[model samples]
Target: MAIPGYDSGNVAEFALERAGARAEVVAGVVPDEFGLERSGRDPTATALADAVEFVGLEELRAVDAFRIELVYDPSALPPGASPTDVGIAVETDDGWERLESTVDLEATTVSATLGGRPSGSTIVAIYDGTGES
Candidate 1:
């Protein structure tokens, strides 16, 4: 939902899109620093931090024969014209860690690649929420 050219109200709307890549975006958390402020008039103002991180992942596995393709519309989900960092959790026999790769956000979609993720059984998840990105 969080398209490069769009900025909604929620940070989860942001997605990590790539090509020829297999992976899932997990734990996406955008901690916007919110603080109370006092001015000459209104004493109820808050500051927000503009940062991006993984909050959730569709989930993937080479053992479960699981693969998916993420294709959804990022229409006004996270209304912003900036690219966000995508984090992922790769499931393996040795527990899990952070997945390192490139996630490019196109004009209409997002894609990702995870260590040359399994072919054929590719899984793609697109933003399908009616909210803004």
Candidate 2:
């Protein structure tokens, strides 16, 4: 099966693998920004575009529930910015809801559990206290 409008090279391949399906690129590519690059100098180099569109991955839709995990490096954040300063919001039929979060600074990840979400709810994560978005 061929999927249209996805990255042509590694991104599509990776999405296919993650989807656990065999799919070919039928049209348009997923673009380089969607793929990871190890340029020798930066072995951990990865660029996740601000947004990505995935098609034909019904398996992903099977997720009954999910947790939002925001990972950040303390050193990368502005001085004096605490991990608790961040928060996540999920779009509901009525409006946005703030999720109760757990902060794990050692792991540099903040997690918030969101029960089952609507099919196409937008999740917005922001620096709630004081910092950049």
Candidate 3:
């Protein structure tokens, strides 16, 4: 599925595999700035783009896994932050959880394969000078 950006002209694509039931997915980009708090583990973590929301994911049951890919503009990143420093984060009950994701520098995209279906908001995050890139 291709999710169009609300105003940034960016697009996010996702794929659900091994879903137990049919899903009624509605996805869109939240063009507003997202203020992500700094964590002890990643004090320099910052939001690189607007939030992406995936609604109706609750309709999917017993899904094995899903993959999401977000495209972002390079200009949106802070100075000295490369695309390699970018990762995917999902809003959880506790807080925003960063997912293990891979960055395609050539495509300006970051992707992650999440185990099971996640019903919440997601965003592109960058950990400045963390060397995770």
Candidate 4:
């Protein structure tokens, strides 16, 4: 299995929102492993209990993929929203636009296959609902 980890979104941004702290996010592919790994770590927890990771995607196509891990935190969620309501958005030359993707509550992450080759400079916004900011 030639599963390659795709560079998709900002790890810091995703971890901050999930951990609600200046947490650490681990990204990149594992050596000799065919899968993408992402995690949001809370130092206070000091373990994977409060952390979130997404793995085992078949492949990455055009565009980019983001694994947003939003733990069950009432404060992190806006009114009328739940952890499962997490959404994905991307910033293009036109402006901030909505990108369709899949969300896995079990994994506590949202994954998207975008249509452009996003570099480190690409801006990816993971927000709640289809709201405009």
Full-model lDDT for every candidate:
0.28, 0.37, 0.51, 0.35
For model 3, give the RMSD to the true fold. Answer: 11.2
Q: Could you tally the backbone clashes for each prediction?
A: 48, 6, 0, 2
Q: Which is the leading candidate under TM-score?
A: 3
lDDT of 1 at 12: 26
List the candidates' TM-scores in order. 0.23, 0.39, 0.59, 0.37
Model 2 misses residue 47 by how many Å? 15
Candidate 4 global lDDT: 0.35
**lDDT tens digits, residue span 3-89, model 1:** 233234321222233232222222233233311111122111110111122222223222222122233333433455233333223
List candidate 1 segments past 4 Å from native.
1-69, 81-104, 116-133
Q: Which of the two, 1 or 4, has more TM-score?
A: 4
- The TM-score, computed over Cα atoms with residue i paired to residue i, of candidate 2 is 0.39
Writing each residue's lDDT as its tens digit, candidate 4 over 1-133 gives 0112632243322234434211122234322222322343221221212432323322223223333323333345556765445544433456444445455666555444433333222222254554332
RMSD of each: 17.1, 12.8, 11.2, 11.2
The digit string of per-residue lDDT tens for model 3 on 99-121 reads: 77777788766766655566454
> Which residue pairs clash within candidate 3?
none
